[model samples]
Target chain A: MSHVSSSPKVRGGRKAAVGNVGRPPVAWALPGILFFALFAIVPLAIAVYLSFCHWDGLNSPTSAGTANWTRLFKDPEFRQAAWLSLLLTTISWVFQTPVALLLGVWAAGRQRSRAVLSAIFFVPLLLSTTAIAMLFHALLDPNFGVIKEIGPWFGIDPNIMGSSTGALLTVAFVGGWQFMPFHTLIYQGGTRQIPQVLYQAAEIDGAGMFRQFFHITLPQLRNTITTSSVLMIVGSLTYFDTVLIMTKGGPGTDTTILPYLMYRTGFQTYDLGYAAAIATALVVVATAISLILVRFSGFGNMRSTREGM
Target chain B: MSIDTRPVTRPARPLNRTRPAGAARRRRWGNPLAGLGSLVWLVLVIVPLYTLVSSSLMHQDEALNGDPLAFPTNPTLENYRTVLDSGFFTMLSNTAIVAVATTAIVLVLSIPVAYVAVRTRSRLSGLAFRTFLLGVAIPAQAVIVPLYLLISKMGLYDSLPAIILPTAAFAMPVAVLILSGTMRDVSEEMYEAMALDGASPLRMLWQLAIPMSKAGISTVAIYTALQAWNGFLFPLILTQSEENRVLTLGLFNFMSQFGVNIPAILAAIVLSVVPIFAVYLVARKALVNGLMGVGGK
Candidate 1:
C-alpha cells in the first residue's frame, strides 16, 4: 500500500529536478468543467431563476415575484407530494437496507451456490427501470395481471395499484426490487473488506454468527451504510421513470412524489415556473443530504477509506 | 488503487493451515435464518422474472386464462415476433446510439479532468474536482425543465444529441470521481520514471495513465452506457418524435400500445434486457466492480 501522506514530501524533494514537468496543466480540465457547467450548473441556476417567474413555456417567462414560492408553501398538493416523497424514501430505506445487508453478508461467503444465487439476484439491476415498472404493471393489473390469480393466497389485493396506500407501497416496493441488488453489492463489498482476523478473533471468543454480524459486520459497515443510504435517499427523491410508466402518480396523486409532481407541473400542466420551484426545492434537499454525506464520509477531501491501513 | 481491485495472489499455504476446520463448517451451516431469508428473496425475484419470460411465451388468451405460475404447454415465439415488428429495432438502434455517444463524450471530457486532478497540484484543478463532487448531488430530473428549454433553444430538441448531451453531462460527476480515484493509484514513482525519460504530460496521460486506468475507464464506459440505455426522463422530456425514442421510452410507449396484449408487453421487456444481459454474462466482474464503484469504497 502506498502512503499518500508521504507524497507531498516526495514531490518537494523532486521539485527542482522535475518541476511539474509531467504534471498536466489546469487547462486540461477546462473542457470538462465548461461542459459540466453549461449543462448541470447552468440549468440549476435556470431552475432557481425560473422558480421566481411565471412562464407557460411559450413566451418569455414573466416575473412571478415570490408568487410561486408563496403558493408553494400554501399548496396542499406540494405538501402532499413532499410528504409522499419522504414516506417513500423512508419505506424504501427500511425495506431495502436489512434485506440487502443480510443478503450481502451471506453472499460474501465462498460457497458455490452463494455465487450462483448472487448472480441470479443481480438480474434485476440489469433491466431498465422502465422495463421493471412495465413488468410489474402487467403483473399487477387488476383484471388481467397475475396478481388477480395469486394475490388472495398472500392476502394482497389485486387492485393494489388503484388504492392509495397500495400505490405508494407498490412504487416503493418496485423501486426497492430494482435497487436492492446494487445496495447488496455495496454491502457485500463492505463485508469483504472486514479483516478476516476480526471474525476469527470473535469466533475464538465463542461469539455466535449473529453476534459476530452484529458486533463486527455491522460496525465495520458504517461508512458503507452511509454511502448507500445517501444514494438511496437521493435516488428515491428523483425517482420519475417508474412512477411515470406505472402509476403516472395516480390513484389521485397518491404516488406523486416530488419529482413526479415537478414533472406534472412542468410538462403535463405546463406550469413550468411552478415546476421549477418544486425542482429547486428538490435540488436543495438532495444537495443538503449529499453535503452531509460528504462531510461524514470525508469524501470531499478525496481521502481513501484505506488510508490508515 | 482501482476501486475494487484487491490482491488475489496472497499465498494460501500458511493461511490454510491456520484456518479452523470448524470455521469452514460453520460458514456452510451457520445462518439458517439468513439462508431462509435468501430463499424467500429468491422466490420474490424469480416469480416476476418467471412471469416475464413465461407469460411472454404464452398466447394472449392463455396468459389471461391460464395459471400464471404454470409453464406454457403451448409455448410460442409469436409475442417476440410482435415486438420485433413494432419498431423495436428502431428504438434499439436509437438507444444504442445514445449509449455509445454518451459513453464516448463522458470519456473524452472526464479523462483529462481526472488526469489533471490527479497529476496537478494547482488550486484550479482542485476547484474543478470539487465542482464535480458537488455536481454529483444535482439530480438530472431537477434540471429537466431548463434542459428542455436549453435543448429547444439550441434547436436540438427531438434529436439524439439532445438526449446524448445531457445524459453525458449528468454522468460526468460519477465518471470523473471513479476515474480520478483510479488515476490517483498510478504510483508517483511511475510518473517520475516517465518524467526522467522526458515524457510530456499528454504523452504520459495517453501512454501511462490511460493504460493503467483501463479498469476505471471500462467502469465509466459501462456506467455511462447503462445510464444512457436506461435513461427515460431525458428522452421523454427533451425529445418528441418516434425516431428519437430510446428503449426506456419505447418500453413506456409499449405499455399503452400493447395494453391488454400482456404477452407482447412482456416480450418487449424481455427483448430490451437481452443486450445488457449479454454484457453481464460476458463481463460480470467488470460490470459488478463498475457498479460497486458507484457507491465508492
Candidate 2:
C-alpha cells in the first residue's frame, strides 16, 4: 500500500535498493523452499554421502573407497539386471508407444466409442500393480491356471518363471499391458490438439487413412509419443515391485534388475553402504535419462512458450 | 550419456506417405482381414482381464475341475467375506490414513512452493525444482537404507508418519512440477489486479491465486493421493505389525498366506481395490474435470 501511495522518488528508491530482485517472492517461496530442503535436498545429500562409505546396515562400515564401484563393474548380477532393465524398457516402449498412439488416434476419431475403449485400457493402469502382478501370477501358474490349461494348444509350456528368458519376457509383456493406458491417455490428449480440419482437408485432397496417419497424425503426436515413452522407460528401468511380487527375481538372479539388486543388497544382505552406492548410481543414470527426455522431448520449449504468453 | 550414442535424440524422420488410406484399404478391404487384425489386438488385452475377474468369482472346487474362463456355476461372496473377516479392514484403514495424511501434506506444501516457482521463475527456484525432480529420478530403493536409518534414528520407524512423510517427499516433487505448470498459466494480471486493491499476500493467495490454480492443485492433490494409496515399497520396508500395514503391504501378506485360496485372494484383491474403485466410480465427474487439468507433457 505504501509503495502504491508513496511518491515516485520513494518508490524508485525502494526498487533500486532491492535491486529489482522482486523480494524473492518470499510469501509463496519460503514454505516450499524450507520443506523441500528438509525433505528432498537433505535426503539426497545423505544418499550421496553414504555412497562414499561402507557402512553395514547395523553398524559402522569403513570407507571402502572405490571397492564397491570396482565390484559393481564386475558383478554379473548387476550386469544382468542392467541389461534386463534396458532391454525391457526399450522393448516395451517399442511395442507400447506406436500401438498406444494408434489406439488413441482411432479412439479420438469418435466420441462414445473412444471413451469405452479408453476406460478398458485404462482399467489395468488404475488397478493395483500388485493385483496385476498377482493376476499374471495366477495366469502363469503352469499347473491349473489358464495358461497351463491350454498349454498344449500351441505346443507351448506355461513356464514363464521357469527360465531366465521367460521371466524377463513375462515381466516385459505384463509391464507393457499394464502401462499402455498411460500412453493412450497422453496420446489421446495430443491427438486432440490436432485440428480436425487438417484431417478433413487431407480427406478432401484424396488423402487416405494411411496418408493422414503418416502425414498428419504421426507428426502431430510427436511430443505425446516422446513423453509417454520417456515415462515408460523410467518405470521399466526402476522395475522392482512387480518383479518382486511375481518372481522374487527368481529362477535365479536373472530377474533381479538394478532396483531389485539395490534392495537385496541393502535390506537382505545388510550392506547399507553398498546399497547406497548402487542407489547413487541408479539415481545418476536415471537423472541423465530424465534430462534427455525432458529437454529433448519438446516439452520444455512448449511449456516455456506458454509461460512467455 | 548413452543418449549421445543413441539416434533417438536425432530428429525423427518425417512421415513417409507410402500408400494412401483408400488405396491401402482397397487393397485389404475385400479380405475382411483389417477388422480381424484389430480384433486380435483387443482380444489379447481383454482375455487376461476377463480371466482375472471371472476366476475371482469361482469357488475353489469349481476353479479346479472347471474351464478357467467359465462363469462360476455358483458365484460366491464368501471369498469376499473371508477376506473382509481376515483383518483387511484394518489394512484399508491404515492405508487410508497414510494416503490421506500424505495427500494433505502435499497439498499444503506443494501449493505455495509451486506458486513461488511460477512467480519467481528464477534460477534458484528453477534449481529447487530440479532438486525436487531428483525424487522422480532416484528410485526409492536407492535411498531406502538411509531413509530407514534416518527414520529409525528419529525413532520414527514402523509408524504411519514414517510411511506418510517419505511418500509425500517422494511425491512432493512431481506434485510441484505439475502444480507449477498450472500455476504459471494463471495470468500475472490477476496478481496485479489484487495488489491494486490492497490485497495482502495471504488474502491474494486465498482469494485469487488458489482459486485460479484449483485445477492444477487438484491434479497434484489427487495424484498424490493415488501414489500414497498404491505405494508399495516404503510400507513394505517400514511397517512391521499388521496394525501399521498399508493395503499394498497387506495385499502382499494376504497373497502369501492365502496364496492357494484363489477365491479368498481374489476377494482380498477386490477388497484391496475398493477405495480406488470407489473413488473412480463415485468421482468420475471430478476425474474428468481433473483429467482435463493436465496433459502428457
For each candidate, the alpha-carbon lDDT, in order, equals 0.85, 0.70
Best by DockQ: 1
For residue B159, what is the lDDT in candidate 2?
90
Interface Cα RMSD, each model:
4.0, 9.7
* C-alpha DockQ for predicted model 2: 0.26
Q: Whose TM-score is greatest here?
A: 1
Worst 10 residues of 2 chain B by lDDT: B1-10
Per-model TM-score, in order, reads 0.93, 0.86
Q: What local lDDT score does residue B8 receive in model 1, on the 0 to 100 scale? A: 33
lDDT per residue, candidate 2, B130-179, as tens digits?
Answer: 66655566666666777787888888888998899888888887787778
Q: lDDT per residue, candidate 1, A1-309, as tens digits?
A: 245334532333544666678788889899999999999999999999999999998999999999999999999999999999989989998999999988988877656677788889999999999999999998999887889988998999999999999999999999999999999888877776667767677878888777877887787787788778877888898778888888989998899999999999998889999999999999998899899888987766555444454
Please provide, for model 1 over B103-191, each residue's C-alpha lDDT reduced to its tens digit, 9 standing for 90 to 100: 99999999999999888888889888988988888999999999999999999999999999999999999899889877876677777
lDDT of 2 by residue, A38-96 (tens): 65566667877877788877776577788778888898888887887788778787888
Over 4 Å off in model 2, which ranges? A1-24, A150-155, A200-206, A304-309, B1-41, B288-297
Off by over 4 Å in 1: A1-19, A204-207, A302-307, B1-30
TM-score of chain A of each: 0.91, 0.85
